[model samples]
Target: MDYIDSICNASASILDMTPAVRKPEEGKVVLDYILDNCAKWPNKIFLTQPMGGDEVLNVTFSEFLSESKKMAAYIESLNLPAPSQIAIMSKNCVWWLMADLAIMMSGHCAVPIYPTLTAETVKYTLEHSESKLLFVGKLDTHPWNEMKKGIPAGMSCVSFPICPSDVSYDKWADLIGDNEEIKEIKKRTPEEMATIIYTSGSTGVPKGVMLSFKNLTDTTFGLINTTHATENDRYLSYLPISHGMERWVGECLPFITGLHVFYAESLTTFVQDLNRCQPTLFLSVPRLWTKFQLGVFKKMPPEKLQKLLKIPFISYLVKKKLLKALGLNHVRYAGSGSAPLPPDLLAWYRSLGLELLEGYGMTENFNYSHMSKPGGGRVGYVGEPSEGVEQRIAADGEIQVKSPGMMMGYFKNEEATKETMTEDGWLRTGDKGELDDAGRLKITGRTKEIFKTSKGKYVAPAPIENQYISNIRIELACVGGRGHQAANAILMLSEDAKKEAAESGGKDAIEKELEELIKTVNSGLDDHEKLQFVAVVNDVWEPENGFLTPTNKIKRARIEEEYNPLMEEWYNSKKKVIWHKW
Candidate 1:
């Protein structure tokens, strides 16, 4: 009658890794095994990404270990106390994880910070957590500069690869100063803190969730069992490494499964990088995947593409091949998380021969909760409580969980931590959802984001936003109906579609097209749930503005505040982009 039993014994024909049932008792606790094994498989093309033309930065297993050790030695020389916080900020790349491993190896806790965080949020987090050290990749500047202004005096700092900056950096060769027989200090307990991951900052000021080595290790095993990830698989670490989803899959699981990981340079070029890498398993948040899907549609004008695909023969053959060729071909295992993935998007991705799986987890859970089971076609449900994970639906329908991956507690916030979990110890996931007939988890919506209109209709902004975006334009949409007369959407235009519209028509025409697009998107929703108004964002939301979180989800609260006053005019008027002159 329990959740796991219900899932394992459910009515579905899913792939079972039964004969090779993974036993945690048999898994290694140390991170050394993964690093060492990759060295042994040195010639197997561990990690790679292409540059402008024929130029690629490739790392062999042996090179990875050497660089990590050098960075680790540099980490030791900092002489910070054990459990000192080492924060990482940047886009996903090989060095990002390298610094993360170095922090762990040197006995410091890694705190992942978003590159897109606003100056104010960065100030609050750095000072609140009292993190002494930070490693920023060369990609982002504002967060680093803003964070620099906020830190207290004498806080030690480091940067990836050694850029010339005020903060000290690892010189690689000069880092040998720690030697004269450097002793490797190992924390024997799995409960020893490994990282303090702050919340995605979607709703409010981020809460620092302190996770231990056992939490990371156990979650890695749980993910391995659920996804059947192996040493031979390749992963593209294009997602922001700051988010929990990225930390678990892009960082922890690689240690557990020994998968090779390559980083894409920037968000603008992620798809191109994805094609160059041909990753075996790619993990990303829903926003990016939906953008990729939109890009595919834009390449062939949607009406033309949609009609051609409607023909059974072409749909069966040509359309499938086109999607696969666009770097999506080898993504055997694709996982979506950070924010809930729209079920409609999942079904559409599948239509292109892509296996889209939804994963549920938060920083508080060390990013392990429920993952759709392999071979199980549970479209809307986050499959089952992953191996070694326990899930329960609380009285109010919030999904609560107990797992080895649970954090030690919120950093220096005992009262807040206590409030998050039950007295008996289950971490409460703030989002609300229900358990289906098959015992699978279906996330209905966020409890807080739901708004009730004067007419007595309760509308959850997420589901409404998903309906607008799952198969439509707008990179990300946030709904705000509470306290307002009606609901509206703040949208970021699709990059590819924007470009196509520009080439075919002028900017004014492109803007006009978006208005029509909004009409079509709105037609699918109800009078109450449908957006009462829409705003087309000319510029995309970036991390610098704090309008977007690191995982690329919109910072809804910030957007609402910025646009709060305009609602009157927009709601009173009719078309999209109320601020921009039509």
Candidate 2:
């Protein structure tokens, strides 16, 4: 059977049966639910952050509302262009949410850019939105300055610190000033555009997905049909707010559920924050989940871990201990999306008493589509559709979605917008998938990245690439064989893994060990699926260097471009067996 057939079978065995779907009541907007619920659950924790030397900051629903109101007032006072756009260029932070709500309250649209966005993309976003103000975060100022040339003159720029030279610049503090007489703007129409989230254009210029308040609210509440959230549930907000998954899960869901949200201080402190928060709920992209699984593999050999997992009594004890150690003992609902998840990683986490519900959605729909049941998770598939959304397999197996969360349209690009929507309005997901008799969705490779080798056999890069990176030492993997004789992969090794190998043994010994790793990864694949060459570089793929996303996912296109010059050496030379040849 082909890989898609294999995935379909594998998914059915795990994801086919889940909780009965529950449809949410129609006619609710996210902003309405947030304001109403906040008034009701005033003391419920809304937003949390740590400011003082690694200490975590916690804010209640009342405080979040108050702060949001203050920020709204200041935004209103700005008196810029009417119905203007507010752009937030920052990572995941409490201030990002504050800025989002402030924009909404001021009757404006929000454009949240990815923190790892190229200066060109950033400038494009600002210009595309025709933003009246930029609420710059306390981030590396270099990118802002780099893109300053792209900033439209008279398109006012104000850093969050809102410095002295920043004429009439607004600080977060300005939101809560003594001026309490701010006029109330009417509640947003359900159809009003609330946010414009730019898709991470790992391919090209990022497209702004214009979402209405209704889109978010409907999807979020619809997801709640499968979730059992309470005012007491604790949520960790570590994922980038710019992404629709995080925005809906970390922000929109919290508003309706009244869950406590603790924002991580920074990327370096995320794990520490997770431990400190001990959140009952958490959401992560498959890439990060893969990283964590790799971290675990680094400490314990995969073979040994697999062996230990098989011993019945020992497996129970090991999982219990690991869950308690990771503070995931109380995780009621853990989830992953944005990319396909490796089944091995998914099963390993499930064994640890964590039910990570792998789900699916994209920017256009505000990430409200399908999710696995808490206990009934399907590792390789993003399960059945949620309440109120219809799922259908298109002619070519692309998952077609029609949800209330579907975007208003693509900002500044009407042609692309029309192309994205179906004649009858189903949003084309661009992902290939299959559904079982039970309606669970199993995703195959992306339609875009399926490449052909010299023999004309197709290679679905992600699956093969995921297997290679399972070695723990390989941090980034990009697979391709298009325009080549055979399929090959370029892998960037973990920095620490390289140093560890060198310290433990010599360069030659490490080289041999890496070859063994490649052989092991290759042994599991079919002839066409096996990699012909693997480029294992010792250097790190950093976001600062444009090789990674804000979420630390590899930039496949960029990696391919940078390594195109080395392809001949990697393939033609016998030294290509191990990547150190270059």
Candidate 3:
């Protein structure tokens, strides 16, 4: 029997489940699209970057192109070698995109570093990639202070106008003003390298994935086709541009469609920025989606909101008011990715009239993979294989994919690249999944993340962890107990849930609710997979604390290392729920 047949409905043929790898159509590259947009809509607003309250600077397409060309000329004047690597370290902003365009125009590849990385990791990436120059832009004080130490002294540096005032560098405005705009655009072949994206892994050193111009163009066209993207669409760019999804959807897609892009000022002003943009398409990770829901619950209690939603006329108005306040009333398409969203949460958003969909992808493929169809999505599955994407499950149950936008290789790491790719050219996804009757893909867990208990039965933690977080009281969870009789879950409470615990009788109510939740969750699991107890940890796991990645995915290895030693003690407590301190 075939792998697809093993999991999918008997009537669904294997050929229907796996499509042939599609070749990219010969066409103009992303740079060509930008040039075309400039010629077509020279005076149209291209980027809206916020400053302080009620103040935003909007740049027209002509202005953007002219400034980028000037920056390119300035870069050329430095006499750097062709195909040099230029690094940009900043939060999402307009100048960040401009620096990227300048790098492209200057006939170089860009290396974007996450703004939240530690000094040591930052130094490692820059040194490993051998970046020739660095562009520093919009960042907070503490992060800049920490990240600056990683920059190699005497390295050529340029500063965007909105950068921290503590350090002096050649200013973007002054440099572009001093230089002449290059009259000719740099011509690039489709096969030429475009960028080196370093994966911010949950464990170990980050690997730089090399992608070509054709790879990006192929992925962009696939995205445009599936999403029905148009020039009238609006996008709010808040995620790190260094990430693959943001780079593809937020940065690359806009060039092709001339869509207006808005930059979020800061976390403090995200809601205000969202209101200003009122984006048509929105994408976020599960953590943020949960936070958004919790934000709503903070205003009106969930019980009251549910009761109000049951009324006919009042339900319509309540939904409208809530969605409008969240700045999602205009969102025609919404998506969740990077991690699994609890099904109830997904249902919650859909119930409110937002078309929230789930997607699946990784950095290696430029995130051009599966996405739920507008109205064809299942609760727990990411939609079927995208056009030109081929997927197959190996005998070991790992999902391997071949896509048009697959990376060329890892930068300066042939061994790792070779290990990741199969001889037939498919990229190993490292994820275990199953195909359903409707061809949706349900990711079970990471193959490497599965742990065997003392009874010798392997346990996949993802589904169980999902069960824990589905109860709104828990914000994040990790399930483990590799050598124990049964697994255990460590939980972090949501801010509001914690606040509730501080009030009279609130802690007892939460405790009772959690005890019931664990019982209900355990009833559905295999005996060996059932959790012995759940510990409510006193501290929250965050990126700064080294417990989570910058993207909010837990660093499992770190979590296990910190907690596995005390597993016996936790098990000895003999309580269904335990309050733990580390």
TM-score of each: 0.86, 0.88, 0.94
Tell me the tens digit of each residue's lDDT in model 3 across 1-582: 001100111112522444344333466688888888999999999999998888899999999988898998898888789999999998888888788888888899999998878898889989999999999998888878888999998989999989998869889999998678976668877899999999876868999999999888888878776666678889999877888878888889898888999999988898999999998878777778898998998898889999998999999999999989989888766787667888899788877877567778888988877877766778888888888899898999999999977999999999999988999999998889999988889899888889999999999999999988888899999999888888999999988888887789987888899999999999999999999999888787986566887777888988888887778888988888887762
Mind giving the per-residue lDDT tens digits that candidate 2 earns over 1-582?
011000111233324454455443455566666778779978766777777475556677777777777777777878866678889877667777777877887888888876655666778889888888887664545554554445566765545532223234445575476656346944777778888888777566778889888787777767665665556778877777777778877788777777778877666776677887787776676666766776676677778877888999998887777666665666766766556656766667766656666777777877777767644555566777767789999998788988778889998899999988889989888778888777888877778778887788887888787776665566668887787777787777665566766674555665677678668877887787777767666566766577876556667787878877777766787564554533
lDDT score of model 3?
0.84
Error of 2 at 159 (Å): 4.1
Q: Report residue 203 deviation for candidate 1 (angstroms).
A: 2.1
| Deviation from native of the Cα of residue 398 in model 2, angstroms | 2.7
Query: What local distance difference test score does each model get?
Result: 0.68, 0.70, 0.84
Best by lDDT: 3
Q: Find the candidate with the highest TM-score and give its number.
A: 3
Error of 2 at 525 (Å): 4.4
Candidate 1 lDDT, 198-261, residue by residue in tens? 8867777788988877787777777676656788777877666677767777777776667777
RMSD of 1: 4.5
Preferred candidate (TM-score higher): 2 or 3: 3
